[model samples]
Target chain A: GAGVSQSPSNKVTEKGKDVELRCDPISGHTALYWYRQSLGQGLEFLIYFQGNSAPDKSGLPSDRFSAERTGGSVSTLTIQRTQQEDSAVYLCASSFSSHSEEQYFGPGTRLTVT
Target chain B: AQTVTQSQPEMSVQEAETVTLSCTYDTSENNYYLFWYKQPPSRQMILVIRQEAYKQQNATENRFSVNFQKAAKSFSLKISDSQLGDTAMYFCAFMKHNTNDMRFGAGTRLTVKP
Candidate 1:
């Protein structure tokens, strides 16, 4: 694809429900990342995956937040028992390779936990 | 631990004028990367510019340039000949040279008034 793509551009779910956000990175991108952004707030790093392996999961806010990348091309972020605090825009980005290069971002998925 | 900071919460610039957005970061690692990303109303994060810590010369792209002072840990973006299209939230980000974790600072909202 031309750039990173994300599914379910907007999602509204009841509190406590589980939601999954998907990201399809560029054709050859090997580094995938997830981030959360609140209204008028800065982006918070969630997790990073490199080549189907996540070497750093330290940014996951809680046990309910988890992510996995398969084939080093596609990734998914799952939020279990979503809370109102989880209502925000979830972003996905991928770079050609990790090595401090530029990252192309997706049209983030806006998740609203009602 | 690496942390990025953008102290200016908001800034306004007139068309054709110039404005500088301030950013500072703290890190124990000497080799890393710094970046500036812009997010408009459309909600897509776009890379503005990047700088390698080892590079002494500042990075520049058209009207956008960075003043990077490694000793003072300051990386500021100077937007010369500003345009209304430049109005958006600008973020400062840091990434370790060998790691996948890209830490971002609280963004500075830049409004380029016509």
Candidate 2:
């Protein structure tokens, strides 16, 4: 089976520009999550979606970050007015369901705000 | 709020030897899940093992095992007969029951030397 996949492995954009990262979860996976990994830091939780339920956006650092899962499969994380601090690797993961413990992760998209 | 901690930032082990990575989490939830994920330089997060909070016995996969102390809120990963492939950043994560959100700790970089 194909693992989770993300588009635009690397993205470099101006600080004030907006960027959108995409994620394709594994087949049959109903739970998806987004995380940020900064240099010399741990993975920071961003947002999560499960099935048709309302997505959890509490982990989102600021209002500039938003995500949406279309048709309960693919997800897109959009960052508005990106800052230099937003420069980091964006990772996406998926699991069988919200109750499933193990999550498979994608290769991640490295976003560099120049 | 739940928090996961990995006190050791880096560790090194000789090939064919054994090494342990410590992890501790703070959570009030009675039922949850603990996981160990390995992230190589390729930037893919791969699940190594997982332990359910209700389970008394530890979880093991091949040479990878976990010492899960629910009472102490501790989950440690032990790798026996370490191989070069084990050289990567190990992350300890916590997922509360019935939720899609996961909290991760600061990773521990393990270097397997021959």
Candidate 3:
């Protein structure tokens, strides 16, 4: 089966620029999550979505960061006016459901803000 | 808020041998979940094992097993008959029961030498 896939495997952008990372979850997966991994730091939860329910956006760092899942399948994480601190590998994962199911992760999109 | 900790930054194990990785977490929530995820050079995070907080019994996969200590908030992974393919970055994660919020720890880099 095809796994979760992310677009723009590597991206380089200037500071203050906006960037969008896309994620295509597995077929029929109702739960999707986004995380960021900084150098030498742990994976940081960014956002989560389950079906049509309101997303768990508490983990999003600031207003500049936002994510949306359209059609309950593909998702996009947008960072407006990116900063150097926002440089990290953005990982997307999907699970069978939000109820104690294992998550499968994408290869991740490495974002570099210069 | 919950935090997962992986004490060992790096570890080396001989092929076909057994190795154990340590993981500890801090959480005030009584009901949660623990997971071990492996990320290879391709940087695809793969589920290794998972343990439920309410369950006393440890979880096990083919070559992987977990020692879940609820009182101590410890969840360690034991890899038996390690193979060269086992070399990767391992991450420990925690998820609360009511939410899709998942927290991951700084990874442990495992090197399996033949």
Off by over 4 Å in 2: none
List residue ranges in candidate 3 displaced over 4 A. Answer: none
Native contacts matched by each model: 0.89, 0.77, 0.70
Q: What's the candidate order when arranged by decreasing DockQ?
A: 1, 2, 3
Give per-residue lDDT, candidate 1, residue B3.
91
Model 1, residue B63: C-alpha shift (Å): 0.4
Candidate 2 lDDT over B21-102, as tens digits, reads 9999999999899999999999999999999899999999999999999889999999999999999999999989987668
Clashing pairs in 3: none
Q: Cα deviation in Å at residue A54, candidate 3?
A: 2.1
Clashing pairs in 1: none
| lDDT to native, each model | 0.93, 0.94, 0.93
DockQ agreement of candidate 2 with the native complex:
0.77
How close to the true structure is residue A62 of candidate 1, measured as C-alpha lDDT? 100
- Candidate 3 lDDT, A30-93, residue by residue in tens: 9999999997677888899999999999889999999999999999999999999999999999
Q: Give the winner by lDDT: 1 or 2.
A: 2
Kindly report which residue stretches of model 1 are placed more than 4 angstroms away from their true locations once superposed. Answer: none
* lDDT minimum window of 10 residues, candidate 3 chain B: B96-105
